[model samples]
Target: MVSPVTVVKCEGPKLVPFFKATCVYFVLWLPSSSPSWFSALIKCLPIFCLWVFLLAHGVNFLVSRCGAKRIFAGLIFSALGDAFLIWQEQGYFEYGLLMFAITHILYSSAFGMKPLDLKAGVVMGLISSFLYTLLYAYLSSPFTYLVGVYTALIAFMGWRAIAGVQLCNDLWTWTKLSACIGSLLFIVSDLTLAVNKFCFPVPYSRAIIMATYYAAQMLIALSAVECRDENEYKKKIKVT
Candidate 1:
């Protein structure tokens, strides 16, 4: 017979399988149920918990510790914007857009502060402005307008990143590349959301949009981790 301690050790791996089974059952049962307040609350509970985890652990703790103070603040603002967007009652969308616009600006500033290249900025600005105008013409929503502004900011920052490749003396290329990829994913997710909101009524639209959005957010968090790792590597090199 196995000792009690050995039995407990053997059962540990089973816990994950049991938890996954429970979650699967709960999710499957959720949409078929009656329309009650508690039912709605239960349906949204997982997403609410995810939002809290992203804010508290992913953005606040991880990014703050990674030496990206301004970016962390911007992410907090973006999380607030996400909350406002999810509420979906009243005219909170506009406020959410404003908050997110500020977030994009903060992120742009954080990334672009060192480059100081006016020519690149102007070129990116012109291209982004034209794209924004085209998207606005097609979309005609306040959310689209906000996305336009955010796109322009991203373009500016992206240009800075490209230009600064030569100037990255500390050789944190991987971190920078990860950040660039994360930014691109974020743009793709935003564009997908805009399409979903304004253009076509695709099936499983919410699922697709949320999946992309969450993935983009997670990529951004990974960029923060990359930054932290790069910083530590540089510190180690200096000490050696």
Candidate 2:
């Protein structure tokens, strides 16, 4: 039998701070004020807390070592990206796009391309192509190229995240599924944001975008954690 210490390591309690911070942001911060650096920091507090939890947690296990570092970096970038977008200061849009593009690249790399799932890739490509085509006329010169690259990066990230589901067999299945769903939600959130910003105004667009974005980040972060089987986890906690 696995030792109690090992069990505790593998079956540690989840990060509660993330959820608490998320609730506080949506309830107290999202609609309170105009765009500012402070608002952005408030918006990204949950993600920042998640990053801290990953670093400080007792668990030594990880779904993937390479993935862990990449996702952590991605979280940092994501927070920076949020700050730019939320502030919406002069030239901040481009900076936001740049940060988010890097975030997607890191996420895609961490998700890995082990199975070579062409089907998922093709689907992501088709969707991104369609969206870009739709947004083409509205995009100005610099934004045209910037948005295009960002779209491609996000699509690649989504493809990798969805394709990773195939790697799941036992304990990792939930995490795989979590990532898959998270990626899809990220796409939805971005799609809504793009439409509202470039194409036309979307009613309640801010709420929709932030809602999906937060959930996507949360789930993706959770998926990176090392998961244990139910009975095994129970025993581990019992021992602890």
Candidate 3:
């Protein structure tokens, strides 16, 4: 088993920059209803930059720790999703959602899950199903079916993130919790996007969506790195 200290070391420094960037970008780019065209584009720039940063970070972690390829692919897809979304009003909304859908699938695969606690998993599934139904009820055609499928994918991704946590000591458990929280934040980000797009616009919804979105991506990226390191450490112990 990987020691708890190693897990902490892997997570500590990486998390600081991720969280710092998330916070700094959110404050600097709070969405304005009356932004000039150039200003709007400038605001959208940070998300792309953050995605690129995380993509590089994930690739480096994989290089050093033998991380799962799916995690790396997820980050790439996320960057593509951000790129597509920056032009969402220019009719790239569907393409953006499609990219994010693929990202969620890759993420779920990397954070592989099993039905460890049947009762808990069942409860989580039921809850997600209910929420999915509620969301689908409000959406209209073209978007209705697409949004329905995306919501279900994200819900399951979140569920699996939680279920994938190993039964280990506290620090190691936190690594899993990071993944779980990240996945849930992703769900929140998309849910807010759906509400802002389909249901009704909340004032300054973009700020909420982007804040959660970047934070989610960063935490998930960090979790992927730490997970890879922990697993490698386990293999080393086994071999020795």
Candidate 4:
């Protein structure tokens, strides 16, 4: 059996602090009367901390275990995306999107989703088509093409994540569930950002976007802890 000390040591140390920082950022950003510079500082500070936290988790995952390398890599890409997007005013939006695109690709690889069943495939295709049509209607020329490509990647990643949830034998486990939820929330957060940027304004959109994004990242990170190697995990199961 795994000892309590081992569990404590292997688990992420930054989860609590990350959430605390997120809460503080939200409080700072959401209030209408809050100073603009304060809000910007709060936003940038937490993301810097978040990237650091993810890097630490990636190191822990890499040194202590195998089969989690893709997850670690994904976290690194996610951190880069977070850092780039934090400075959207400095013409970093495209760079940020590229980082996130890489992030989604890494995450999709980590999921290791199987070929989709027919119904799931059909549904995902229809959803992707509808989203593309809607987005294209709203976007301008270059962005129409650019965002379309990005959306395709996002849709593929989301499909893979959902497929993992359906096909993984550990569907009932916290790890699988967390990844699935995280994937869904990631999509939601990105869509919100896209709509706010490309379509219309949503009040307190930044708060909504950041909250969902942070939650998604946290869940994805937690999944790494909740799940290790399938072989090792199965061995533990058999021993118990």
What is each predicted model's overall lDDT from 0 to 1? 0.54, 0.79, 0.68, 0.69
Worst 10 residues of 1 by lDDT: 1-10
Query: Where does the lowest 10-residue lDDT sum fall in candidate 4?
Result: 1-10
lDDT (Cα, 0-100) at 44 in candidate 1: 41
| Candidate structures ordered by TM-score, highest first | 2, 4, 3, 1
Candidate 4 whole-model C-alpha lDDT, 0 to 1: 0.69
The model with the greatest TM-score is 2
Clashing pairs in 3: none
- lDDT score, residue 151, model 3? 73
Q: 1-240, model 2: which lDDT tens digit per residue?
A: 333455435534555678788888878755434676677778889899878767754435433476877888899999999888875646678888888899899988888887678988998899899989999999998889988988999999999988877644433366677778898999999999999888999998888998999899877886676443567756655665
lDDT of 1: 0.54
Tens digits of per-residue lDDT for model 3, 64-93: 643346766777777667666666777888
lDDT of 4 by residue, 1-240 (tens): 333344334444555567678778766554533334455556555555655655655577566654256666776777667666666667777888888888888877877656455665567668878977877778987788878888888777777767766544543455666777888888889988998888889787877787788888777766666544455545544554
RMSD of each: 10.0, 4.2, 5.5, 5.5
Q: Using lDDT, give the best candidate's number.
A: 2
Tens-digit lDDT track of model 1 for 1-240: 223343233323323433343355365654422344454444344334333433443455545553355556566776666666654345566776777677666656656555466775687678767756756756665556567667776676566544444434554454455455655566666666666655666677656654555455443433443323334444544543
